[model samples]
Target: MPLSFKPVSGLRLRWSRLFQRAVIAAAISVAGTAALQAGDDQPNSLPPVLQSSKLRLEARLAAEQGDFLHAAVALEQAALVVGDRETAQKAGAGRQQLEAQGGAMADFQSLMTLIMEQTAPPAQWIMRGDETGTMTPYMQGVFVGAPALAGAMAMTFDNSRLSTAAELARTANSNSDVLETSALRLVSLPRLEAEIARLQKSGQPIPADAAALAGLTEVQFLFVFPDSGDVVIGGPAGAWAQDEKGRTVSTASGRPTLQLDDLVTLSRTFADNGRGFFMCTIDPKPQQVQAVQQYASRLQLSARNARQETQKLEELLGLQNVTVAGVPADSRVASVIVDADYQMKLIGIGRRDGAAGMKSYFELAGRDERRGAAMDALRWWMTVGYDAIRVAPDRRAFEFTGRSVRCQSENQLVKVDGSREATGKADSANAEFARLFTEHLPQLAEKDVVFADLQNIFDLALASAMINTMDLDRQAGWQPAVFTTAGGFETQPVEVPRELMTAAASRVYRDGSIVVQVAGGIKVDLREVISNPQSFTTAPEVSSQARNASPVGQTGRWWWDAAVR
Candidate 1:
């Protein structure tokens, strides 16, 4: 995913503001100079070199002030005045930077536009988080309750089958094989919200301070869908509904703490009206911004390269005769293949957008993606080790199955051969792994503390298992090896394999050793009773006060009959 913006690190925004003030002054000075020059009417032609130099300096000045839009305009003017290749390149780069900034500026404008257009009361305005640009509607409760669900969700991969999956995916033959995965979620949002509201409105005393706020708790809910593919963020549901009085009272403490429970309830009721799901942080830190910026830059560069290549392709292809094919409703391509005795056929379509050249685009895309995946695998090896172990157990194993190729050009197929010696229960291996984990823990924690231990075990176990199982001499149909867990609560799968069920558990539990499932916890609801309450049982004194009846056949039968009547 492309990132939103570059988070200026270390340099405070206050400093940027000061610099901007100075740049504004410079702009005013430029305006003044241009006015005076125009008044003289001396051919109104500044020297091309002088104009270009001034424009470049002005662009730099604007850039230093972080006014990328203005900087790009200056650079464009410079490009026009100088008429030099270098100047053109600089202008091109500046324009790209401005385009990137345009997205951020659009986001800012969108936010402002929303704020200005909202007709809600001033007190009802949702508080916006600086980091994620999410609005938090005021809750009718305490702020000090529960830890806000925050931080990046850790990504997990099954090292055992990753190599097989990666290889098959990269292979051209695997295109026909549809590898399907589904994302399943068990929701109790309705239940959770009602429970929270009930507790809040029970006339309970609110916590006095931050320390007392520790009593408010939140459980991390891990939703494990099938690990069929990468999990991307789905969009959020709409807002909760209000009553006739426009009351959306969720808590009693009068302080808003819009937690997951509130989201669930809101999502359940009148959706499309509330503060939607957004990634937010209490304190927007520099490190987070840097991550976003790096991603954004990489995406933008990729886009420009793609554009240039397309342009080049168009220049090469010139024009071509095109054909149209129409098939009847019941046409069959299988018959054509069968009649031809099942011969393989490959086709390529070359299309371009500009004067450069046309090339087989899909091939290039595949090659680039393959290279990126290989590079990522290498980095993962140095940093995580587990990734390398997934692909190849040792030097021998790497050579066995014929590693997947990373094609650089149409003809060149480059294979990445990375191997790590995998040994289990070996004194040296154990010692080495321990040392590595000890070194990595602190840095790993900064990213995600919960899954660090599990990932470490994954690296070791996968490496060890691959070492033992991946032997070319051994016949095919080798059962995929997996790390065995000790014991725990087990559940029956509706139809899927038992191992998949366990895999789902592993995604939730931090300790890979434990077989635990993340299930919906508890939910409650409260409503005032309008009618009088009645008792089913009576006390001894009350029992005596209650009347006793005689049998129908005796002398008192007449009295019993009368009473009945």
Candidate 2:
């Protein structure tokens, strides 16, 4: 048993460093364009081929230095500047050269995919409002000021690797759903008369039938003894039961169950219980638990680092928080909150004009995109950065004491504590957003690469609705399965009650998100957490019909998106 909850370093941004690269790239691009176009007024003399080539070279340099977004934007701008020139002889030749040169775009795509897979904000982040108009994030994403930087930096880690490992473990243990880690117990009590005879012959106290023996079922046990320190038992179903006084009931006899404080009585009772069960426990030493936590933390940090790199790219491309508010009408950003933990308890966009306003969550954009590409770009930009936010903690510590039960049945005899210390850390969304933008925003904007289709639409709400319909909400920690493809990952189908069609449908409408329901839409979140492909027979069922109402026709659905994806 180990504490599953532990704090790991989060992704952090280096604002100055990112901004410096953007400025340099923009300067080169603008200067090159001006110099090349000096002689020609009707058509630029630099030629699309040379422009693309120069941009390509710049991309190579940026990527080599780990400025992926800048690199990607450079290549993208080259393409845009040369649009339709793909048919011209010079343009075709240049395109061929660019394609032939181990292009960086593919690498960019792979990197973005990895970031999306690895990055996830905590499940819930708390936003606090101060009368002074400054806000603080509570839980996981926090910022700490760097000495003399005049601004702050926000950091948080990722847990994708742990999730992958756990997933792999589950896949390998398909046949054994319940992990066997502790001792298993099996016992058969002899008849009262037989027990008495055995006690007499062995010069032992007679076991009493009136005595109570408790058993645990499907429980794994971690037990620590004064000398042994730690041991793990598989299927620990039975242990010496503790009485009301919180003392170990070591033995049963005609007199009364007696509490034992020493190993003599404990060992004698187990020996007396016969060879029916072995009492084992998982490691209980604090250090042992800490060791597992460190392992988890390492994995978390790797994920976090990867995520931060992705965020850097997003910020550089102007694909994160492309919208911000409250700046003086004429004020260019004087000081930016690099890691502004953009969190909202609620956000609603007016159906009439998409004038979105947020209540608990801060608005990254001062004004909503009015229409067309601006709207699309705004959505794409916000989506790309959403997974990087999380809750910040006021005071963090790292203490935990929890048990892991592994068995269920007779001879249970294991108990141990192994949870790790809980640590509280700060989360600052404002600081992160500011750092990414202050340096990289202008460069990305100049390149005109304003949108990134890097949105993660796993849409927890859709997944949960599907699960509710399946009636699996009663089960705790039953996560949805995911299946990914070229189009993206599809959520696992979930189990639901036959009657929750309308309830599920309404949830989808409220979110205004579209998903392809494999089965007409019966509200199944299992699509995301479907580990047992064989066990899942029904796909999610969706219909154009309103939630709860009967289908109007054969075309009517209970949980299908009316809007095309």
Question: Which candidate achieves the best lDDT against the true structure?
Answer: 1
The Cα local distance difference test for each model comes to 0.20, 0.19
Cα-lDDT of candidate 1: 0.20
Model 1 backbone overlap count:
13
- What is residue 124's positional error in candidate 1, in angstroms? 30
lDDT tens string, model 2, 1-565? 0111111111111112111110000000000011121122322346886666555554443332222343344545555667733223332343334233312122233333222222232111111122111111100111110011000122212323222222221111111211122122211111112333445467775222112211212211111111111111112222344444332232221111211111111121112111101111011123322332233222322222434433332222221111111111111110111111111000111111111121110222111111111000011012111111111111010000111100000000111222111111101322232233323422322221110000001111112112222222223222211110111221222221111110000011112211100000000111112112222121111111111111122121111111110
Candidate with best TM-score? 1
User: Which regions of candidate 1 fall more than 4 Å away from where they truly are?
Assistant: 1-187, 205-565
